[model samples]
Target: TIEMKADKTLSSVLSARAFNALMMVDFWNPIYSWRRAVLMQYVPGTASFDPESSRYDLEDAFITNVKKSGLYTQGDRESLEIQFISLLEVELEQHQKRIQAYLNHARDRLKTSEGLLGCLTLAESRR
Candidate 1:
């Protein structure tokens, strides 16, 4: 079913150059989604929305791009922002959990190494 849909979408952009152009559009769509997801979490607490600040600039650009997409024109800006932030909260929480797990793993490895060193020191003393 997906392959059939891809074929239908491909007909309009038949040549390699045309397909390349289409691919760029396809690639940025997910990138934009990811940017929106990340910015939604951080932008609200930021002190400055000035262009000089990279985070603010990114947030502004994402909002501007979404506006031009014409999909959420019916919703108020605040509503849209809240919706996006809530939509990705679970994903953000899961990301934090993953980072914590990695840290715990590192700590565990350090403890194991310390124990091995203690045992080696005892063996050397006995010898």
Candidate 2:
């Protein structure tokens, strides 16, 4: 899991682009089959993990910290969440387009090489 700030600054964009490029390569030959991503705007306050307690408690603590940050009000939280979802959807669409373009280029190169090889074989046969 890669964690990054979603502020969309220059550094953030570069980091995301690098990560996306890595993911594209990994998609073809995966070192791991599954990739889980989490994007959050604000850093959460530190909390202690309790093996005895349920996961819900830990999650609640994190959420509480997010609210305490005062970056988003209740209404703003819903709007921001929707915006983030939209951003992710657009990013996925763009990534798919990039993958398709790469595949098409590779296929075209393969076809051209095969055609050239076939012509050479035909010339040799004629000789």
Candidate 3:
């Protein structure tokens, strides 16, 4: 079992978002496939792993770290918030595009399978 410390900034951010961690291990076993149990230790400020929230947090961390590193001109909190919102919008748009593409692919595959099934039925009827 490995123990890890959460980043102080991330801990503070998560605490501000109302996440308090209890010392526990979340067990996971795939109902249909896996029989082995996977144990995950819950650490403070790291209990939940929501991808969308994680993405936003990562962006926020990146912006703050970059600003602190003096790589870019530091903006006021309002401006930073605006920038973060814009970044989130862009990310959401990209995710939507990916979802649409996946749906289109599934639709195309269904069409192809239907066509193949029809051909097979016709062939079997003539046989």
TM-score between model 2 and native:
0.27
Q: Of models 2 and 3, which has the larger TM-score?
A: 2
Report the candidate with higher lDDT, 1 versus 3.
1
- Candidate closer to the true structure by lDDT (higher is better), 1 or 2: 2
Q: Flag regions of model 1 displaced more than 4 Å.
A: 1-57, 60-90, 114-127
How many collisions between residues are there in candidate 3? 0
Pairs of colliding residues, candidate 2: none
TM-score on alpha carbons, each prediction? 0.24, 0.27, 0.25
The whole-model C-alpha lDDT of candidate 1 against the native structure comes to 0.42
- Which number leads on TM-score? 2
Q: Model 3 misses residue 117 by how many Å? A: 9.0
Backbone clash count, each prediction separately? 0, 0, 0
Residue-wise C-alpha lDDT for candidate 3, range 47-91, written one tens digit per residue = 333445442243244334434432234555434233332333344
Could you tell me how far off, in angstroms, the CA of residue 45 lies in candidate 2 after the best superposition? 19
Give the per-residue lDDT digits (tens) of candidate 1, residues 3-120: 2222233332133332232223223243344534533443323223333432223334444444444444556555444344234334445545655786676567558878668757
Ranking by TM-score: 2, 3, 1
Clashing pairs for model 3 are none
